[model samples]
Target chain A: MTGLLDTLLAGLALGAVYALVALGFVIIFKASHVMNFAHGSMLLLGGYLTAVLHEHLGFAGALAAGVLATAALAGVVDRVLLQRLPQDPRAAHVATIVTIGVDILLVTDLARRIGGDLLSLGDPWGDRVRTFGPVTVPDSRLAAVAVSALVIGAVFALFRYSRWGLSLRCAAEDTEAAALQGIRLGRTRMLAWCLAGALAALAAVFLAAFPATGLERTTGQIALKAFPAAILGGLASPVGALAGSLVIGLTEAFVITYQSDLHVLGDGLSDVAPYVVMVLVLLVRPNGLFGAKGAARV
Target chain B: MSDAAKHLPRLTAAVVPLLVLCALPFYLESYWLRIGLFSMAAAIGAIGLSLLSGTAGQLSMGHAFFLAVGAYGYVWFSGDPGPGLPPVVAMVLAVLLAGAAGGLFSPVAGRVKGMYLGIATLALVFIGHHLMLTLDGVTGGFNGRSVEPMEIGGLVLDSGRDDLVVLGVPFGAEERLWYFGLVLLAFTWFTARGLLRGRPGRALAALRDSETAASVMGVPVARHRSSAFVVSSMYAGLAGVLIALSFRRVVPDHFGLVLSIDYLAMIVIGGLGSVGGAVAGAFFVTALPLVMAKYADQLPLVAAPGSPDGSLGPTEASRYLYGAAIVVILLWAPDGLHGLARRLRSRLRSRLRREPPAPPHGPGPAEPVTPAPTTTAPSVPVKEHTP
Candidate 1:
């Protein structure tokens, strides 16, 4: 019972972190209709910034700087590169491929700079744990859950009430209609990219916290796990992303916890459990759990 | 002009290149031959991907999975630990095995469309990797397995029998494999071009442009989609067999997500939906890193392999260059190298004739022009529902 509880807590904490990244994917897809493949590298960039600056700026200041810098970089990428492309439906697919190119560039440069070295981000919680009855949890895990819930709640509120959110929703619904109604599609889309970037940066902190061995170059690849999370929820749904992340998190946690019993599936089943779940899910629901079936008009 | 007279120049143009490629093994060193071999193998795989992702308008990120099936299948069929069949039979069976794997996944492949298909196929790569690692009996797990050199009747294609001489040049493994790669590449080119130009090619292209429209025109959408996938997998399998033969070893690491991405990059950089483009792109993408690594000492700002100093290495440098190349090519050219070459040739021809250059319209003097679609037609039929 205690082991199960421990696993549940760990899964919840992982899901929260994954939710942060998966939510980024949802926001970007909703606004621009382009799957952001460069997101993994962007997370790495944010983490790298925080890691390199924490020594001088302190953890809080460095984290704030990192998030803001990442947001700015995403905004610039949209304004400078993606926005310059011809505005057409086909451009969305092209933009997605372009992101793959950008990812390669970012990952290569960052990996070269990192060079097999692990750097600490100097978080407030360093190997600290708190025992709650039968279960012991890391301070960082608790912090992750609390912070993610707060941030996600605030984002939901913003989406529900903010003017930018209204414009973003309207634009995503119908680009031409929204444009006629005086919404700046470019600005709304760019803002969505910036917001997603900020979320990814925040998630990077938790990803590199206790239990993980600091920030390495391949840390970006861990962010790729969020792809299954995002896709499972449907690309356009934020709430779905949260649910999907939790499901994936729980599945991975259970698989790792019970690896000895499931030895027939081979070692390291946890690493690929999310993808397996995703494929099975997709087999049943082509558009994802929450995605609507689009009807074609002749 | 008579038809034969008109075709003479084109025939000579094609024949000249063929002669040059055939003669390369005799003149070039083993290192260059090895590079050529890898490029040829990559070209075959890239051509397969081009058919599926480029011409058929489906996106696949699991190509590496099929390639692995071929590699491991060949190793198991021919090696002592398994069936111990003849190398030629093993090679054919390996390709068929890859096709059967595709057949197993056809139901999903047929139903999934565009970007959705791409993500769905991502599952295959992870699953395939897991299977490769776990099925240690066949795949040799992490360390992988050695490949048996191909033998036809009595002629061996490995350095183990290094006694043969050809025109005063020692016919080593690289030398033998060079001709073998050329033959396979030729087969790929012939088959791929034929498929593209035939009725099936037209149907696939139509489907890519508009699935609804294609189906309305009496094209069987699901069957065609799955068949394209099967054919593409077969090509990837053949490429895998050649890759294994050349390397003399098969490892799970070589067939990873990166290899799939590399194949995608090849088709895109070459000019999607073009056979010549796939070949060119494969050569460029494969050779760039290797050539850069070879001449790292001469290149500025690139540290040698394993250098302690924290500087950009040849591998990283090459990656940056190609990554940027993909972006720049998509941005500026959009039509890729094949298109660029076509335009250049047309311009040169016009200049020689002293006639004013034809306005850059659709087709030029190129034979049987299949205009490569610039974008994949939207697979999702209607407006996305907002929740």
Candidate 2:
């Protein structure tokens, strides 16, 4: 019973971090229709910035700088590169492929600079654990949950109340109609990319925090787990992303914890478990759980 | 020009390149031959990817997984502690195995649309990687296994034993594999071109343009989509087999997402839906790193592979070039190298036709009185060039 509770708690923490990353995916896809394949690279870039700068500036100052820099970078990429693409929806795939290219470039440069060394992000939570009744949770895990909840709540509110969010929703609904209504598609997309970038930057801290072996070049790849999370909920729905992330996070955590029993599947099944769950979900729901079936125009 | 006159240029364009490729093995040394071999293998894989991603409008990042299936299938089928089938039979079975794997995934492939399909296929890579790591009996696990050299009626494709000479060049493994790759590539080229020009090709293109419209046009959308996946997997499988043979070894790590991305990059850089473009892109992507490494010291901004920190390595330099190429080409010439080539050829043809009869006694040809409009811009309609 204790083991199950512990597993569930760890899963919740993992899912919270994934929620941050997956939400970013949903926001980007909602606003721009391009699956930012470069999201992992952006996350790594933000984390790298924080790790490198935390020594000079305090951790909080470095974190702010990293978040701002990443957000600005994403916005610039959208405005300068993606905006130049043809407005046709079919061009979305091409833009997606372009992001893969951008990812390769960013990852390559980062990997080269980071080399084989692991760097510390200098987070406040450093392996300290808090006990609740019979359950003990790492401070970093608790911080991840708290931060993600606060940020996600703020984002949801912004979507509900902010003009930019309204414009984004409108643009996603009907680009032509939104343009007619004078909603700037370019600004909405840029803002979405910025928001996603900021979220990814925040997620990176927990990803590289306690229990994780600091920040390595390949830490970006761990963010790939969010792909399944975003897909599980449907690419366009925030609530779906949250639900999907939990499912994926729990699946991963349990799979890893119960590896001995699941030895038939193979070693390190945890890494691939999320993908397996994703495929199963996608098999049943091609558009994902919350993804709407696009009406055929022709 | 008359029909025959028009056919002359196209005929020469095709035959000239074929002749040059056939002649290459005789002239080139072992190092260059190996590069060509790898490029040929990449071309085959890229062409397969082009069919699915380009013509069929399905973006798959699972190509390397199918490739791994083909490679491991051949190895297991022919090696000891397995079926131990004849090499030739094993090769055929391996390709069929890859196609069968595709057929197995058809449930999702048939249902999913473009971007969704791309991410769905990502599952294959991770899952496939895990299986490769765990299935030591078949895949030989992490360290991997040596590929048995192909044999046909006691004539070994591997080196030394057969001791056959062609044109006194000393027929080595590279030389033998060169001809083998050429035959396979030629078959791929002709068949892919035929498919593109035929009815199924039209149906696939229609499906890509719009699914509902294609179904309305009497196309079996799901069947065609699955068939494309099967055929593409077969091509990838064949490429994998050829690659395994060329390497004389197979490792699980070789067929990963990076390999799939490389194929995607090749087709995109070459020009989507263009067979010749895929080949060009494959050769460029596959050979660039090797060539860079060979000339790393001579090239500016590129250092040796393990050079001190901060300096750009050969592999890194090539990656940067291709990554930038993907961005720049998409921005400037979305149609890729094939489109660029077509435009250039059309411009050249127009220039030749418009060359005001060389001034009788002038040392150089006279400039046209009116400013000749640039024909290089993709926007300029190449009406006369279109078939």
Candidate 3:
């Protein structure tokens, strides 16, 4: 019973981060029709940037600087690279790969500069482990869950009723059609990117406090998790991201904890476990747990 | 240089570069020699990716899977000190095995297209990595295996005579590696070119442009698609063989998702579907890192605004270079270096002959990009999804 509770708690905590990342992925994909493979890289950048700032210039300042940097970087991406793409839009294939290249360059740059041994990250809350009966949770984990829930509500509400949200939806639904109806596709996209960047930044800051792993592998691993959650949540659905993330997080935590004895493939199949879930979900429910079948693809 | 050369400009363009490459080992140092061989090994992977992504129009984010197969397949068959088989044969065996693996994995591709396929392939990479790390027998666990230097009967390739003297002129071992690379390249080059020229290439292009039309026209869409995957994997396998043989060892990390992205970058930067593009892209990507690593310390001014050293950190610089180049190439030069080269060559030739640049690139109208469409900017390593 204790193990089950611990596994569930662990799942919810990690899933919170995954869900936030997924929300970020969904926003960019929904608005721009671009998958934004660089989202993970951005998330990592946010974490590291905040850590660097926090270390150098207090917590509030670091948070402000990190958010600003992420938004600025997102805008740069939009204005410089993405803005120039042709409207016919099959170019996403190349675009996706280019993002990968950008990610490699960005992560490599981060790793080279912050060449520390242990996966160092900044957690202002300190690394304090707390327990409740047999089910123990870290201070950082609870904080992450809290932050995730808050952001999810804010983003979900903003998208539901806000005029900007309406414009974003219009742009995503049919860019040309939206343009005809007076929505500035470019502005909408840039704004979505900014919002998504900030969200990813938030995820990064919280994750840093929790995982504390260095940026190198963290970038890739975080990206990998976000992918399953984002896809599982539906490309256009933010709430789906949260739900999908929790499901994936719980699934992984459960497997990691319980299946140690399974020893199916020598080590934990847990490494590729998320991907297994992703593939299975993709096959059975191509649009994701809550994704609209017609609108979402991958 | 006749104004009216009978051959397509591609053939003429390749001739000079080919000759220049063959003689590279003579001029370049051993350090460069190593990079040259590495490029050749990478070219093998790039060519495969070029065919799959560039020509077939399918995005695979799991290209590293095929690379790992080739790297490990050779070891499985020829186990360092176990077989003493010729390196060329080892490469060929690796290629065949990888092709088989590609073929086995082809079923998922049949029913699933676009992002689904990308997801499936992405899963493969993680699975492959897990297998490599966990399986102690085949992959040599985590530390990876250190292969013996390739021996060609009398010659010990890894060490020994660093250069082969002919006509009293010393040619370095790197030069020898280039020769070896060139020979293998010739085979891959011919195979890729043959595909592009033949009915199959046309069919593949047709499938990419419109699957329904091709299927309607009696093209076995599934079969052709699967065959393309198989061929692509074989190319990757050969590339893997080259990589393993060149290093005289293979680490699972070397064939991770990053490697797949590297291969994709080559094809995209070079010009998809053009063998020349694949080769050029491979060289560009391979050489950039070597050059950057060498020059990063020398020229610190090019570092990002925040980099402490006032110069780009070598590894980071290489990645930064890779990202910037990829983004630039994709957005500004969609046609890649091959396309860019063609445009420049044609423009230059037309100016020299006074015939206006032969309509710039192709005769087709450039697609009108609207501001409304979603912009997928970032590059996802193997198994990219953009439907």
Candidate 4:
């Protein structure tokens, strides 16, 4: 009973992180018909930035600096690389991969420049592990869950009620029609990239903070697991992303905790375990658990 | 073949590599020979990837998984002690097992394409890496298992012998490995060339152009796509076996997502659908890094744990190089080096003469290049006819 609760709690924290990453993907895909392969890398950048800021500059400053830095990077990357893609809309996919390539290069260089022995968010949460009923989860995990939920709720409200959100949606639904309606696509896309970068940064920061200070290749591995969640939730559905992430998170936690010797399976598989569930779900429902079908495409 | 490719004007151009290799043992140092041998193994893998990604239009971010399957599968099939079977049998079995794995994984592709498909392949790489580390009974995991030294007709090659080394320096088992790698390269090249020029290859290319249209035109899109995956994986497997034989060992770290990305990068650099492009891409990528790390001595900013300086490492720069190369090629020559070479050759041939404009085959344009997805087709009447 205790183990199950613990897994669920940890899973929810991780799932919330996945949801944030998936939202980043959805935001870009919705706005530009562009799949940001750099989404994960962006998240990594955010985490690393936060780590540098928090450890080297202090926590409050790091948080602000990470967001600003990533948003700037995202805007520049979007404008310089993705903006000049071949006119043929079908060519967007190829261009997307290229942008991803660029992001990878950028992140790698950054990581190299900020050389360190290990990766860490450099948080001081470990000394205080609190217990509630059957669950004994860390403060950081609890904090991540709260933050993710708050962010998701805020974004949902903004999209549902705001005029700007409506305009962005209209643009995503029909680029030509939206252009005629006077929607500024450049501004909308720029906003989307900035928001996406912010979300990725927040996720990476909280995720790194929860367990330890830094990350390794395992950080990207975590981001990779979010693919299934993104797929399952419907690539365009933010609500689906959150839901799908929970399912994936719980599934991985359960499987590893109960199934065969996990130690042998290696740490890499644990990072990707949720993808197995995602793949199985996709085999049955291709559009995803909550994908709005045609509405998801531009 | 294109108009230029049809006439074999430069047969000696192709024979030059064979000549160089035949003479290389005498001139080059053993260390360089070893690098060349490794390059050949990687080339074979890249050629296979080029077929799957370039010709078939399927992107795999986890080909190293197939390579791992081939390597570990070979080791398992060999005698339980490790390096179980004769090296040749192990190699062949690896190919078959890899094909089987590809076949099994193919169905998942039917449900997804683009980044989703890439996700699946990426999953495979992570899974394979884990399996490599965990399956200690067969793979020997972190410690790994080494291939037994070569035994040619009961005359065991002396591993400790210095005289047999290629360039007055001791090469150990590399000489034997090179011979094996060359044989496999020949086989890989033959298979890729034949497959790319055949009906299946055409079908693959057609599907790449437009999947729904390809299906409408009676091509079995799923089957061909799956089959391409299978064949490409088989090539990766054989290459893996060669790699294992070369190292006489296999490690989980050896077949990771980085390698998968590197393989994909090579095919892109080489040109998507050409066998020659694959070889050229492989050599360029493999050689550039080797030359840079050794001769250029450019250090990576962050030294990976194993490095001496704690400053920068070759491995880190290698990734940076590949990532930058991906961007450069995509932005400039989306068609890759093969595309660049073809264009250059065409321009060179036409440079001297101000020939009269040739009659166009389709649209009567002066330039006969067939740019895909031309918007201004004779289908103007369809728009007029539409309500």
Candidate 5:
């Protein structure tokens, strides 16, 4: 029972980080209709920035800089590259593929710079653990859960009341209708990308903190796990994304913890457990759990 | 002009290139021949991907999984630890196995659409990788298994075989494999073209344009979608067998998501929905890094393969170029290199005829060039939903 509880806690922490990244995917897909494949690289960029600058600026200042720089880069990618494409139905698909190209370039450059060396982000919660009864959890994990909840709550509130959020929601509903209603689609989309970028950057800190060795070139790939998370919830649904992340996180944790029992499936099943869950889920619900079933007009 | 008179130039154009490709192995060194082998294998796979993603309007990120199935299947079937079948039979079975694997996954493949399908297929890669690593008996685990050299009658496609000289050039494994790759490529080209022009191809294209309309038009939407995937997987399997033959060893790492993306880049760069484009894109994507690595020392900023100074390497340089190419091509051209080449050919033809240049956009005067139905026909009017 205690072991299960421990695994559950770890899964919840993992889910929180995944939620951050998955929410980024949902926001980008909602506003622009383009899946940002460059998101992993953007997370890497933010983590790299924090790692490199933490020594000089301290952790907080460096993280702030990283978040800002990443947000700016995301905005620039949208404004400069994606926005320049001709307005057409295929444009969204084209833009999504273009993000893959951007990811390649960014990952290549970052990997070269980092080489085989692992760099620490110099976060304050270093190897510290907090105990609650029989449950002992890393401070970073607790911090992750706390921070993610706070950020996600703020975002949900923004969606509920903020003017920019209202415009974003309207644009997501109907682009032409929102435009006629005086919403600047370009600006709204760019801001959405920026917000996603910031979220990705924040998620990077907890991802590289405590239990993880440090920020490495392959760290960005961890963001890929969130793809299933985002897709599992349905691309357009934020609440679905959150629910999906937890399910994926828990599945992965349980698989890893019970590897001996599931030996027939193979070693290192946890690495791919999320994907297995995702495929099973997709088989059952093609549009995802919360995805609206779009009716064909013609 | 008479029909034969008008067709003479086109026939010559095709034959000349064929003759040149056949003649290449005799002149080029093993280094270049190996590159050609890899490119041909990639071309075959890219064509398969084009049929599914470009022609059928489904995006798949799980291509590498099918390729792995082919490679490992060939190894297991032909090698001692497993079935120990004939190499040729093993190769055919491997492709069929890949098709069966696709058939197994058809439940999801038939239902998932567009971007959702892409993400759904992503699961296959990871799951496939996991299986490859654990199923040590068949796949030989992480180190993978050595591929058995293909034997046809008396001729062996291996370097250890009896040496034969032709035209003062000693025929080696590379030389023998060059011809094999050529045959496979030619087969791929012929079959892919036929499929694209045939009834099934039209049905698949219609399905891609709009699911509802295609179903209304009596197209078996699920069947066509699933069959397209199966056919695509079979081609990937064939390509995998060729790749394994060339490589002599099959590792789990080679068949990863990155390779699938590389195939995607090839089809996109070459021009989506065209066999010729897939081939061109394959050559461009596959050969670029090898060529760059060979000339890395002379290049401006590119460091050699493994310099410790952290400078830009040839592989990294090629990646940057192709990555930028995908973005730039999509942004400006959208139709890719095949489209660009077609436009250029049309312009040159019009100029030679002493007529004014064709309009900047839209199809040029219908030449006797390969009929690209996807290019001329308007795409099905269906609004894409973000599900």
Candidate 6:
């Protein structure tokens, strides 16, 4: 029972981080209709910035700088690279593939800079644990859950109240209608990309915090697990993304916990457990659990 | 002009390339030949990917998984501690095995639409990687297994065999593999072209354009979608066999998401829905890094591998180039290199036929050459037409 509880707590923290990243995915998808494949690299960029600057600026300052820099980078990528292309709904898919190229370039440059060295982000919650009854949880994990909950709540509130959020929602519903309503589509799209980048940067801190060795080249790849999370919830649904992240998080945590019992799958099944759960869910619900069933008009 | 007169240039264009490729092994050194071999293998895989993603409008990221099935299947079926089948039979079975793997996944592949399908296929890469690592007996666990050299009749393709000299050049494993890769690539080219031009290709294009419309026209939507997966996997499998043969050893690490991304890049860079484009894209993508690394000394910005900390390495430079190319091509010329070639050819033809005034009703003669964004800006999103 303790083991199960411990695993569940760990899963919650993991899920929280995934939710942040998945929400980023949902935001980008809702705005531009292009899945930002460069998201992982963006997360890496944020983490890399924090790692490199923490020594000079202190942890908090570095974190802020990292978040701002990544947000700016995301905005530039949208404004310069993505926005230059015509917004043809038909060619939107091609535009999505272009993100892959951006990802490769960003990832390559970051990986080269890091180069087999694991650099710490100098986060305050270093190797500290707090006990709750029979279960002891790492402080970093607790911080992850708390920070993610706070951030995600703020995001949800923004969606519920902010003018940009309203414009985003409207644009997602009907681009033509939104455009006619004079909701600057281009600005909203850039803002959306910026928000997603900021969220990705925040997630990077908790991801590279205690328990994880440090930030490395492959840290960005860990963000890829969130792809299933975002997709599982349906790309357009924020609530779905949160729910999907939890499901994926719990699945991975449990899979790792019970690896010895389930030896037939070989070791390291937890690494792919989220994907397995995703496939099973997708097989049952094609558009994801909460995805709107699109109507086709000939 | 007579039909024969019209066909003469086309025939010469086709035959000349074929003859040149056939004679390349004798002329080129081992290093260049090896690159050609790898490029040919990549071309086969890219062709398969083009058929599935470009023609059928299914964005599959599980291509590497199918390629793995082909490669490992060949190794297990042909080598000891397993079936020990004939090399030719093993090769064929491997392709079938890959197709079977695709068949197994057809449930999701058939049901899922566009971007969703792409994400769904990603599961195959991670799951397949786990299986490859765990299934130690078959896949040789982490280290992987050395591939058995292909033996057909009395001729052994392995370097261990006695050397055969031809035209003062000693025929080695690279030389032997060059011909093998060529035959496989040629087979891929003709068959892919045949499929694209035949009934299935029309049906697939229709499916891509609009699934409901295609279904209304009696196209078996699910069957065709699933079968495209199978055919694509088979091609990936063939490519895997050739790759395994060239590599002499197969490792699980090589067949990862990066490989799938490379395949996608090839199809996109070459021009989606164009077979020749896939081949060209594959060669450019596969050769870029290799050629860059080889000539690192000559290049301005690039340093040799393991030179220093700050300088740009050849691998990094090539990646930057291709990555920038993908963005630039998509923005400037969405149709890709094949489209560019088509535009150039049309322009040349029009220039030669300048005496006749062009029809005003049709697309302007200069339009194709220029890659006018106005014409292609609103082609249609992948999801809009799919029900």
lDDT of 3: 0.73
Model 2 lDDT at residue A148: 92
- Evaluated with TM-score, which candidate comes out highest? 6
Which residue ranges in model 4 land beyond 4 Å of their true spot? A32-35, A54-58, A87-93, A96-100, A113-134, A158-187, A211-221, A259-269, A292-298, B1-8, B79-83, B149-176, B298-319, B355-387
DockQ of predicted model 2 = 0.50
Tens-place lDDT per residue, model 2, B1-387, is 799999998899989988998999899999999999999999998888888888898889999999999899899999985899999999999999999999999999999888788888989999999999999988899989898888878877888576888988798999888888999899988888888779988888888877899999999999999999999999999998999989999999999988987888788778778888889989988998788667766778677777777999877887777677778877675566887787676667656755777657563333442224443333221111111
Worst 10 residues of 3 chain A by lDDT: A211-220
What lDDT is reached at residue B18 by model 1? 99
lDDT of 3 by residue, B1-387 (tens): 675675667687879888998777666678888888888888877887777776677777788999888888777666743464666567578789999989987776554566546656788788888888888677788877765444566675554455558556565445556677788888888888788778888887777777788888878988888888899999888777667777876787777777766777788788767777888899998888888878775665565445565355566666677677787777766657775666565566545544445544554322222111233222222212111
Q: For candidate 4, lDDT tens digit of each residue in B175-279? A: 555665677798889878888777887788788777777888899988888888899999999888777766777887888877887677677667667787778
Give the runs in model 2 whose Cα sits over 4 Å from its true position.
Answer: B1-5, B305-307, B353-387
Q: Tell me the TM-score for chain B of model 4.
A: 0.81
TM-score of 3: 0.86
Q: Which lDDT tens digits does candidate 5 get at residues A64-118?
A: 9999999999999999998876444444666787898899889989998988988
Interface RMSD for each predicted structure: 4.0, 3.6, 5.9, 6.2, 3.0, 1.9
For residues A252-290, could you state the per-residue lDDT of candidate 1 as single tens digits?
Answer: 899989999999999989988999898888878877888
Consecutive 10-residue window with the lowest summed lDDT within model 1 chain B: B378-387
lDDT of 1 by residue, B243-345 (tens): 9999999999999888887887787677678888889989988987788668865778877777776777787788887788778876654555765676567
- Give each prediction's DockQ, rounded to 2 decimals: 0.51, 0.50, 0.40, 0.41, 0.62, 0.68
Docking class of 4: acceptable
lDDT of 3 by residue, A1-298 (tens): 9888888988898899888778878888777666777887787777777767777777778777877798789877876777776544556656666667667766776666556644445566677888787677778888888888887889888888998999998877777889999988888888888888888888777666754644444653576777777766676788788888888898889888977676866675766788878777766775677876563222
What are the lDDT scores of the predictions, listed in order? 0.86, 0.87, 0.73, 0.72, 0.88, 0.88
TM-scores across all candidates? 0.93, 0.94, 0.86, 0.84, 0.94, 0.95
Candidate No. with top lDDT: 6
Clash pairs, candidate 1, are none
